[model samples]
Target: MSIEVANDANAYLGMKTLDTPNSNNYVEYDGNGHLTIDVGEHDDFDGPDTQPGEGVNSDSFTWFDGMFQLCNQGKAEANISYELPDPPAERDIPGNWTAPGDGYDEQVVGFYYISEGGDDPGEEGDRIFVPEGDSVPLPVGECREMGVRTVTKGVDATTDAPLIDGDVVVTADSPAAGAPNGTDPS
Candidate 1:
C-alpha cells in the first residue's frame, strides 16, 4: 500500500522493511500507487518470468494483508476510496460485467479494504470512513500499518492477469472538508 499525501507540504510517507527481511520484504515507494507488495507468476520451465520476485507465495492470486506500514507525517489521514470516476473511461475492458445468471458468483478482482483484521465492510457497496484527521496518528512521524486484501481471480479465457473492472483510488482532501470519508451514493 502507498501512503497518500493529503497536505503535500506537511505530509510524507516513510518506511524501511520490517526487521524480518525473509518474510517481510520492504520496498521503497516508486509513485506507481503501491509498495512492498508486488507479486507474480509464470509457467514452470518456461519462466517465473525474467525474475523470481521476493516473498514468493504458493498461489499467485491472493496476497493476504499486513504488507504495509504507512507513516503519516501530515495532519490529514488517508483512507482508500473505490468510487468510479465521473464521465467514465474512454477505453475500458469489454465483457459481461454482471452476473451471467441468478445466484452466479461472478468473477471479482479488486482491492478489498481490511478493517481491524476482518472482512471488508465495503463489500455490500457501502464503505466506512475515519473522521477528519483521524487517519494520521498524532505526533508526526507516527506510522500506521495499512492492511488491504489484494484479490485476483481467473475468469474462464480472459487475460492471464484478471482484467480490472474498477480502480484503486487514492486522493488528497481536507479534514474540515469532511472527507477521508464515504457515503452511499444513492
Candidate 2:
C-alpha cells in the first residue's frame, strides 16, 4: 500500500513491504519534487560489470508520480525504478480506475469529471472530492458507475489499510451502501 504525508513542505510517500528491511519504508520529500532514500550498502549490489577504480554511487532520483529511479553505475541498464502514484493524479473524467467494493472485491469505475464549466479540472484534477458532512457521487462512464462513497484517507482498501492522509481511496460498488449506479456513455 501507498501512503502520503505532509512534512513541513514536502510530501513523504511511504510504502509497505514484507521483503525490505523495515516492514514499512518511506521516502523523504523536499517539495521541489525530489525524494531521497538511504538504504544501506547491503541493500544494493552490482550485477555484472564493474571496474577496479570506479566507485559505485549511492543516490536516488525522483520521477513523475513519485516514481523513484535508482541507478548504480551511470548506465541505463543499471537503472531500476520504484513507482508510487502521487496521492492524486489528474485523471480525466470518464476514464478508467480501480475501485473497491464490499468484501474487498475490486471493481472498475468510469468517472465523469464534473466542474463548474464541464472543463477539465486542473492539476490534481477531477477526483471524488470527499468533504466532511457531504455526499459525493462516483465518476461514472462506460468503464464504471456512479455512487456515493466516502473517500478512504491514506488507505488502499484494495491493498493496505490506513497509514496517513492522501492515500489511494477504496470505493465499493456492490449492493452495499456506496455501490455505484452504472450508466452508458453512448
Backbone clash numbers for all candidates listed: 0, 7
User: What digit string (tens of lDDT, one per residue) describes model 2 on residues 49-147?
Assistant: 543221112121111121131112111111111222232333211122223223322222111222333432444333333232232322221111111
Which ten residues in a row are the worst by lDDT in model 2? 71-80
Local distance difference test scores for all models = 0.35, 0.25
After superposition, the stretches of candidate 1 with alpha carbons farther than 4 Å from their true spots are 1-28, 31-37, 42-63, 76-107, 112-143, 148-154, 162-168, 177-186
52-124 per-residue lDDT for model 1 (tens digits): 4433222134433444454545444433233322312332222433223334433222333234423444444
Q: Can you give the TM-score per candidate against the true fold?
A: 0.40, 0.16
- Candidate 2 residue pairs in backbone clash: 93-113, 94-111, 100-171, 100-172, 101-172, 110-144, 111-139
